[model samples]
Target: MEDDIYHVVREPEFTALFLLGADDLVETVEDVDAELRLPDGTRWSASFMTLGAVETVMNRWRETGEYGGGVFFRCSDLVIVPKGGVPAMIEAFRAIVADGPQETLGNLG
Candidate 1:
């Protein structure tokens, strides 16, 4: 259920995005050489590459008719679920986006 949280956070030079499916967790982190690390242990390698690769992954899964009951979203640079999944993932994304990183959770670092 927790694995339903698909996210990708990065600074200016790198991008890392992951997708959570009903039966699988597909993830991608590009620019692995730029040396930027997010709290989730994902790192951005460079400054130009984007989460576009992440989109590609999501699109692939969406095209597959097999994964039919998962939540779905295209968060900033991350894509999450399709059809249906744990509700907590949505709440988590909201909390993380609205309060955790920008103006609140000073300790999420």
Candidate 2:
């Protein structure tokens, strides 16, 4: 099996500062349902709900300054590092956000 790779689809001028700023704007919970461990031994975890919610907040903040909601993680706290490359991480997070809790969790009837 191969690890999934996601590419950042944002504007070409997007910089690390923008991603860092978005990271600073997030709030993570103490518990997480899913996690990804990096090659460096660091772990990243969060529920489908939390990831989706934070993605919404980040998108809003990026497009407009009308962001007033909070971002959080469920199973574990949300931590945004440039591991796996900043763009790849950002894109993966975006995909997770787009999938949302219900879809990601496969809550289909």
Candidate 3:
């Protein structure tokens, strides 16, 4: 069975969140340029992620019909723009990817 966990982590400029779900090992930083935009109104271009994170995002899409276009991605405890109000979600995910956190790792498994 797949264990899915969802929660929000509020920050000064970003909303850090995580979601875990069933299927596949997503072990790679994915460039979700087509799915998200940067602060300057540009596509997000980078591959920063883990296997578990990718699985979580994919699972969310399959179940909720969200981010179906592959524009956004979830990385363990890092969710970029879940509510879609602020532009800081992208930056938050980047920061977490650069520096692994206990919270992020906790959701990996």
Candidate 4:
């Protein structure tokens, strides 16, 4: 699968930084049947109700390279070292970010 063809990296550091900043501003990850708290006082008691979206999205990128709806820019950052042609790279990218029920990640519903 493209998972092997493309060695993608979402940069946990970047995600951490981004989410953490949002946490600082918004202050919580609500709707998990409970409040999902981030480090410190960032409470998820409100906003971002679709926690499943989180797992769904993160796993989606793992399966394909682009992340659903093409929101994840990191896929573009990944290199096909040894310089696999652009078509192969694009194919691999699409393979990673396709929209569907991911097997290992399970259904969002």
Most accurate candidate by lDDT: 3
- CA lDDT scores, all candidates in order: 0.36, 0.36, 0.39, 0.30
Residue-wise C-alpha lDDT for candidate 2, range 1-109, written one tens digit per residue:
1123211133332211122222332233221233433333333343323344456556766666553432332323344333323444445545554455333332212
Question: What's the lDDT for residue 49 in model 1?
Answer: 23
Stronger candidate by TM-score (2 vs 3): 3
Return the candidate ranking by TM-score, descending.
3, 1, 2, 4
Model 4, range 57-77, lDDT digits (tens) per residue?
A: 666776776555445533212
RMSD of 2: 14.1
Residues 1-109 of candidate 1 have per-residue lDDT tens digits of 3223544434343333334334433233331211234546543222212345445545667777424422353333232333222232333344444443333222223
- Candidates arranged by lDDT, highest first: 3, 2, 1, 4
Off by over 4 Å in 1: 1-49, 65-101, 104-109
Off by over 4 Å in 4: 1-49, 67-109
TM-score (C-alpha, index-matched) for candidate 4: 0.18
Structural similarity to truth (TM-score) of each candidate: 0.22, 0.22, 0.22, 0.18
Error of 1 at 98 (Å): 17
Worst 10 residues of 2 by lDDT: 13-22
Give the lDDT of residue 15 in candidate 3. 40
